[model samples]
Target chain A: MTAEIKWVFLYSLLTALATGLGALPFAFLRQVSTRGLALAESLAAGLMLGASFSLIAEGSHYGLTQTLTGGAFGGLLLLAGKRLLDGHDIQFGEIRGAGARRILLILAIMTLHSFSEGIAVGVSFGGGQKLATLITLAIAVHNIPEGLAISAVLRPQGASLLACAGWSIFSSLPQPLMAVPAFLFVETFQPVLPYGLGFAAGAMVLMVFLELLPEAYEKADSENVALWTTLALVAMVLFQTYL
Target chain B: MSSTPILSLLVAASVAALATTLGTIPLSFDLKAKRRALSAAYSVAAGIMIGAGYLLTLAGLESRPSACILGAVLGSTYSFWLRRVTGSKKFDDNDLESIPVEPKEVDRFLLQSSFHSAAEGAAIGAAAAVALPLGLFLAAALAVHNIGEGMVLTHRLYSPQATSSHPNAVPAPLLWPTSLPPAALVVVTKLPQIVLAMGTYFLIQVWPEFLPLALGFTAGALFFLTLTDLTPFAYGQGRREWVALLCSAAAALVVLGQSFFL
Candidate 1:
C-alpha cells in the first residue's frame, strides 16, 4: 500500500474504533435510575443539538441560496418519509408487523444521513496530509459521544451493552468506505459537498427538536432539563477550543 | 508512495467504524446510572443537537438568505404536517406526570432513535465532503454525545414492572406494539447506522453536487422536527418561557461566541 493511503486508512480506522471505546462505560452499569436516565438524555441532547447547528454554520460557505434550497429539500424528504410511515394508509394487519416496518422506515432515513460522513472522510484526504490528519483527529474524538448517544437511547430501551456498542459502530461505517473514493477524485466531488452537508445538518436539527429533545423533556423535568442541557453544550463546545 | 491512496482510505474508514462499536463495550460492566442521570444525559444530548443545527447547519447558510429561509420554513412546515399525519400527539405537560406508556410506544421510540442515529451519521459524511473542519467538529461533538447514548439505551429496558424498589415509578402504560421480543426489537432498531454511514459516504463521492440540496434537506427536516417533534413536548412539560429562553439563549451564545472567537 502507498504510505499516504496507509496513513489515511489507519487514521480513519482509529477514529471509527473510538466510537466503540466510548461504549465501554455502559458495560459496567447493570441498571440505571430514573435520575440517571434523565442525565444521560440531557447530555446526548446537548451534544447533538450543538453538532447539528455547527453543521449549518459550516454549510453556509455556499451562501443561503444553496443552504435554504438544500435544507428545504431535506425537510421535504423527511416529511415524505414520515408521511409514508404516518400515512397509515396501509392497515396494520396487512403489514406482518407494523412495528418492524416503522422501524425499517426510520432506518432508511438514518442511512440517508450517514452516507455523507463516509464521503467526508474521503474528501478530507483530498485536502492533503496535514489537513487530513487534523480532520481525522477531530472525527475520532467526536465519535466517543456519538457512541454514547446511541447507547443513551438504546440502553433505556433495554439493549445490552454489546448491542449498543455494535450498533453505534455500525452507524458510522460509511467513513472508511467512502474515504478511498473521495480521495481519488477530489475536484469532481468538491462542488456537491455543501449540499450534502446541508442535508445532513437539516435532518439532524429536526431530529433534535422533533425526536430527541422532546423525548428528553418527557423523561426529565421541565425545570432541571435546561440546566443539564447547558452543561452538555458547554462540555462539547470545550473541544472547539483546540481549534 | 508504496501504493495508491486507496489502501490508506480503506483502513482509516474501517478503524473509524470500529471506534463506534468499541465505544459500546463499556455497557457490559456492572455500573449503573439512575433515572435522573439519564435525564441529564438526554438534556445534554438535546443541547448538543440544538447547537449543532444552528452553528453548523443554520449558520453555514447565513450568506444565502433565500435558501436559509426556504430551508427553515420548509423544515418547520413539513414537520408540522408530518405530526398531523403520524397521529403522534404531544402529551400535555400537565398530564406528563400521570400519562401511561406501553411496550408499543417503546418500540416506536426505538425506531425513531435509529432513524436519528442514521441521519447523524449522514451529517458527518456530508460535512466531510464540503469542509474538513466542519466535518471534524460535527464528528467530535457527536462522539461525545454517543457515550451517553450507550448508557441511555441500556437503561430503557428497565421497567417498574420488573422492579419492586421504586413503588412510585409507574409501570409503562402504553402497550408494546409488536410481538417481537424486546431484545430482538432493540437490535433491529440499533443496527442501521453502519449501513447509513457507509451508504451516505459512497453516495456523496458519486453524486457530489447533490450535497447542497441534501444538506439543506437535512436542515429542513431537522427544523421540522424541532417545530413539531421537540417543541410541543418541551413546552407542555415545563414553564414554556424558562425552558425556551434558557436553552435557546445558552445554545445561541455558545455558537455566536465561537463564531467571533474561533
Candidate 2:
C-alpha cells in the first residue's frame, strides 16, 4: 500500500511536470507578434472554457446543485480576490502592477483548478495503480496545453519562456499535494469532490471573462479573437472528450 | 404497493415549491456592499440560466419543434412587452452603487418569475402523471432548478439598485417573504395539470403536448432575459469585449457539457 501511495504521488508529480512542456513552443518563437499573442490568449481562453465545462460535467455525477452552488461560490471568491488585490502595488520579480496581477490571477486560478485534478488523481489511485496511471497520464497530457496557456498569457507580458514554464508547473503543483490525502480517504473526498471541481470551473470561467478575454481583445480584432477562441475551444473539448 | 399518480404529483409539486422557497434565502443576506462583484455574480447567474435555457430548448425540440418555436416567439414577445411597459433601461453605472430601476419593474420581474415557475410546476405534474420514475426525475430536476430561479429573482428584483433607486420599493422584510408566494403559485399551476393528467382518461395523451410548450416558453424567456438584460448588464459593468467573449465561451461550455455528459 505504501508503494502504491508513493507511485500515486510520483505519477501526480509527473503530470504537474508535464505542464512545463507547453512552454516549448514559445521557446521556438523569436518574437511574438501582437496578433500572435492575441491568438495565444484566445487559445488559453478556449482551453480554460473547455476545461471548466468538463469539470462541471464531471462534478454533476455527484450532484448538479452541489456543483453549481460550489461554482457560484467560486465566482464570489474570484470577485473578492480581485477587489482585495485592486489598487495594491503588487510585484513579482520583474512583473508588477496590472501585469503582475494578471499573471498572478491566472496562476491562482490554474492552481485552484489543479486541486481538483489532484483529487481525481488521488481518488483514481484508490481504484488501483492501473487506473491511477491512466488518469495521471491523461492529466499529464492535458497539463501540457494548460502550461502553454500559462505561457501564452505570460510570454506576452515579457516573462522568459523558462519562467513561463516554471510558472506553468507551479500552477499544477497542487495535484501531488492534494492526491495523497484524497487517496487515503476516498470515502471522505467523494461528496466534496463536486464542489472542488465546481469551484475551479467557476474561477476559471470568471477569470477568462474578467481578465483574459479583455486582454486578448485589446491586441486583435473581434473576428480574429472569436475565430481563435472558437477553434481552440472546439479543439480542447474534443481532446478532453475523446481522451 | 405503489403510490398513485395523484400522490406523486402532489409530492412533486410540494417538493418543487419548497425548493424554490429555500432558494430565496440568499435574499436575506446583507447586500449593502456596492461593487462590481454584484454584476459578476449576475453574469454567473446569467451563464447558468443560459445553460438551463439551452437544455430546455433542446429537450423541447426533441418532442415538438413547431410547438417549441411558437412558444419561444410568444415567450420572447412577453418578455419584450414586460421590459417596455416597465421602462427598464440597462444599468449604465460602474457598480451597484445606484441603479435607475423602478418599482414597477420589480413587479414585472416577479410576474415573469411566477410565470416561469408555474410552467416548471405544470411540467413536473404532467411528467409525474406519465410514469413514477420520469416524474420523480423531473420533479427533482425542477426542484434543483427552482433554487437558481429563486436566487436570480432575489438578485435582480431585490438588488441594491432596485431598493436604492426607488425609495418606495419593496422593503427587505416584506419582499423577503414574496419569494414564497411565487413558489406557492407553482403548486397552484401544477394542480390543474395533475388533475387533468390523472383524473381524466384521455387527457394523459394531451398532457405531453403541453410539455414542449412549457419547456419552450421557459427556454425562450430565459434566452431573452439572459441575452438582452443580464449579459448586457454584465457588459456595462466592465469590459464589454470580455463579457461577449466569455459569454460565448459559456454558451459553448453548456453546449459541450450537455452534448457529452447530459
Candidate 3:
C-alpha cells in the first residue's frame, strides 16, 4: 500500500479515537452544573466560529462569483429545510421519547442529516490528504460533545455507559461510511464537492444561530448571555487569524 | 485515484461512528465551583460559531451587495417569524418555582433531546459533504456547540437533587405557567426555531449562488439571538450584571488573543 493510503487510514482512525477520548470524561462524571455547561458551550462556540470563517476564507480563493453563488444557494437550502421541519412540528425539543417506535422515528430523520455531513467529509478528503486531515480533526473534536449529549439522553433509561457510548458511536457511523467512496473516485464525484461544503456550512450556521445560541440564552441570565455572546464573537475572530 | 473507494468509505464511517458513540458519554462537573470553567468553555464555542458565520460565511459574500441585502432581510424575517410562531407568555418568577417535574420525565426529555441533537449533527455533516468544499469548520463549530448544548440540557433535566440541597438556590423551573404544560410548550416552541434553522440550511444548498445571501440571513438571526434573547436573559437578575460583563469582556479578550496567536 502507498504511504498516502496508509496515512489516510491512520488519520481516520485517529479522528475516531480522539472523539471517543473526548467522551470519556462524561462516562464517569455526572454532576455537571448549568454554569459549567454554559462555559463549555461558549468554548465550542468559539471553535465553531473560527472554523466557519476558515471555510469561507478557503472558498473565496475559488473566485468571488463562485463563492457568492455557493453562499446564496447554501442559504436558500437552509431556509427550505427550516420550513419543512417546522411544518412537521419537529422543531426544538419536539421529540422526547425512549420508546422503540419513537427512537426509530428520530433515527430515520437523523440519518438524512448525518448522511449529508458524511458526504462533506468524504469530499474534503477527495480534495487533498492534508486539508482532509485537518477537517477530520476539527469534525472529530466537535463530535465529542455530541457523543456526550446522546449518552446523557439515554442515561435515565438505565442505559449502561457502554450502551450510551454505543449509541453515540452509532449515530456517527455515516462519516467514515461516506468518506471512502468519495476519496477513491475523486474525479467522478468532484462536482459535488463544493455543494457538500455549502450544505454543511448552511446547516451549521443555522444550527448555531437558531438552536444553540437561543437555547443557551434560555438557560443563562439575559445580560450575561448577551455579554458572553459578544465575547464569544471576539474569540471567533481571534481563532480566524490562526486559520 | 491512489486509494480504493471501499477504504475511503471505511475511514469516513469509522470517524462518524466513533464521534457519535463518544457523544453519548456523560461528562462530570460540579454545578457550583465550575461556573467559570463552564462559562469559558461555552463562550469559546459560541465565539467559534459567531466568528465562523461572519468571517467565513459573511466575508465570503461581502462583494455581493444584492445577495447580502436579500440574505439579511430573509434571515431577519425568518428569525422574527420563528419567535412569533414559537412564542410563549413569560412565566412569573413565582410561577417558575411551582412547576412540578418528575426525575424520570427529565431523563426521557434529555435522551430525546440528545437524539435530536445527533440527528442535527448528522444532517449538518451530510449537507456539508454535498455543498461546500470547506464546510468542515462549520461542522466542527456545530459539534462544539452541541457538546455544550448536551451538557446544559442534561444538567437541567437530571439534577434536581443538587438544586434542592442548596438552601439559597433559586430554581428557574423549565415550565410555562399557562394551562399548557411547560414541557409540552417547550416542545412546541422549539419546533419552529429548529425548522427555521434547518430550512435556512436547505435553501442555501439548492441555490449555491446565494451562499452570501444565506449567510447574511443566518447572521441576522444570530445577532438577534445575541442581542434580544441571550442578553436580556443573562442580565435579568441585577446582582450578576458586573460579573456577567466582566466575563463577557474576558471572553472577547480570549478571542482577540486567539487572533494574535493560535
Candidate 4:
C-alpha cells in the first residue's frame, strides 16, 4: 500500500482503539461536571468558527459572487438535513423499549454518525494532510464521549466493563473499512471532487448551527463560547499564515 | 511504496477509527471543567473549521469559478428548501433533565446521527481528492472535531427530558434525550462517514476534470454551513453578543487581508 493509505489505516485504528477507553471510566467515576462537558462543545465551536470563517474568506478570493453562491447553497444543504430530522417524530420520552433494545437502536444511529465522520476524514485528506490531521484530531476527541455512551447503556445492563468497552470499539469498525477506499482512490475521484468539497462544507456549517451551538447554549455561557470562537479564529489565522 | 486506492484509504480509515477506539479507553473521569470551559472549547473548534474551510479548501477551489458558483447555488437552494419545510422548534436552555430510557428514543438518535454521517462522509471524500496535504489536514482536524461532537452527544444521552414532577422540567424546551442508550448511540454514529466518503470518492474518480468544481462546491457548502451551524454558537445573551462578530471580523481581516468587507 502507498504511504498515505498506510497512515490512514494507522490513524483509523488508533481512533477506534480510543473508543474502547470509554469503558475505563465506569471503573471509577459516575458523573462528569457539566462545565467540563460544556467546555468540550465550546472549544469545538470556537475551532469551527475560526476554521469556517477562514474558509469563506479564502473562497471570497476567487470572486465575491462565486463564494456567496456557494455559501447560499451550503446553507440550503444543511436545511435539508434539518428537514429530514424534523420530519421524523423522534421524541425520546415517547419511545418505549428495554435497555438492550434502546442500546441497539442507539447503536444503529451512532454507526451512521461514525460513517460520516470517516468520510469527513477522507475528504479532509483531499485538502491536505494538515487539514486531514486537524479533522482527525477533532473526531478522535469526540469519540471518547461516544465510547462512554456505549458504556452508559451496557454498564447499566450489568455487562462487564470489558464487554462495554469492546462494544464501544465494535460500533466504529466501519471507519477503517471506509477510509482505505477513500485514501487510495483520490486520483480516481477527481471530477466530482469539487462537489464533494462543497457538500462537506455545507454539512459542516449546518452542523454548527443546528447541532453544536444550540446545544452549547443549553449548557454554557453564549458569550464565553463566542469569545473562545474569536480567539480560536485568530489562532487559526496565525496558524495558517505561519504554519 | 506502491499501493492501490482501496488499500490506502483502508489504512487511513483504520487509523482514524483507532483514534475513536482509543478515546473510549480512558473510561469515565471526573473533569472539574464548567460551562465556561466547554464554551471555550466549542468556539475554538468552530474557528478551526473556519480556517480549514478557507485556507485549506476554498482558496484552492477558486480556480474553477463556474463550478464553484453552481455548486453553491444548488447547495443553498436545497438547504433553504429543507429549512422551510421542517422549521425550528421554540426551545429553552433550562430544559435539561433525565427521562425514561426507551428503544424508540435510541432509534431516533441513531437515525439522526446516521443522516448526518452521510453528509460528513461525502465531505471528507470530496476534500480528500483536493491534494494529499488537505486530505491529511482534514483527517487531523476531524479527529479533533469528533471529540467535541462526541461530548455533546454524550451529554444528551446522560441528561434526560424533564420529568413531569421536576420544577426544572419544561413541557418542550431543550430537546434532551430521555434515556442512557444515547451514550452508545454517540460512539457508533461515526461509522458510516468513511463508507460514504469512500463511496463518493469512487464516484468522483469517474470524471477527473471536475476536481476543481468539486472543491468549489465544498467551499460554497462550507460557507453556508458556517452561517447556519457555527454562527449561533458564538452569540451570547448581551455583552457577549459581539464576541462572534468580533471574532468573525478579525478572521476576515486576516484571511481576506483588507477585502473583508468586500
**Best candidate, TM-score:** 2
lDDT per residue for candidate 2 within A118-206, as digits (tens), equals: 99999988787788888898899888888988898888878998899999999999999999999999999878898998888888877
List the candidates' TM-scores in order: 0.48, 0.56, 0.39, 0.42
Better of 1 and 2 by lDDT: 2
User: Over 4 Å off in model 4, which ranges?
Assistant: A1-243, B1-34, B56-61, B80-109, B160-184, B234-262
Winner by lDDT between candidate 4 and candidate 3 = 4
Cα lDDT for residue B113, candidate 3: 42
- Ranking under lDDT, best-scoring first? 2, 1, 4, 3
Give candidate 3 misplaced runs (Cα > 4 Å): A1-10, A25-51, A62-168, A227-243, B1-53, B56-262
A1-243 in candidate 4: lDDT tens per residue? Answer: 488888887777666777788678678744545654454445444444444444454344345444434444554555554555554545333233343443454454445445545655665677788887876776666566567655655564456777778878887776676667766675553433333333333433444444455555666554344334334333443343333
Over 4 Å off, model 1: A1-3, A62-64, A85-111, A240-243, B1-262
Best lDDT goes to which candidate? 2
Arranged by TM-score with the best first, the candidates are 2, 1, 4, 3
Candidate 3: what lDDT? 0.43
TM-score, structure 2 vs. true: 0.56
Task: Report lDDT (CA) for all predictions.
Answer: 0.51, 0.65, 0.43, 0.49
C-alpha lDDT of residue A168 in model 2: 96
Q: How many backbone clashes does candidate 3 have?
A: 142
Cα lDDT tens digits, model 3, A69-93, are 4544654554455445544533223
Candidate 4 CAPRI level? incorrect
Per-residue alpha-carbon lDDT of model 3 for B56-161, expressed as tens digits? Answer: 3344344464565455445445544544444321211111123233432343343334333333333332233233322344454444444444334334433355
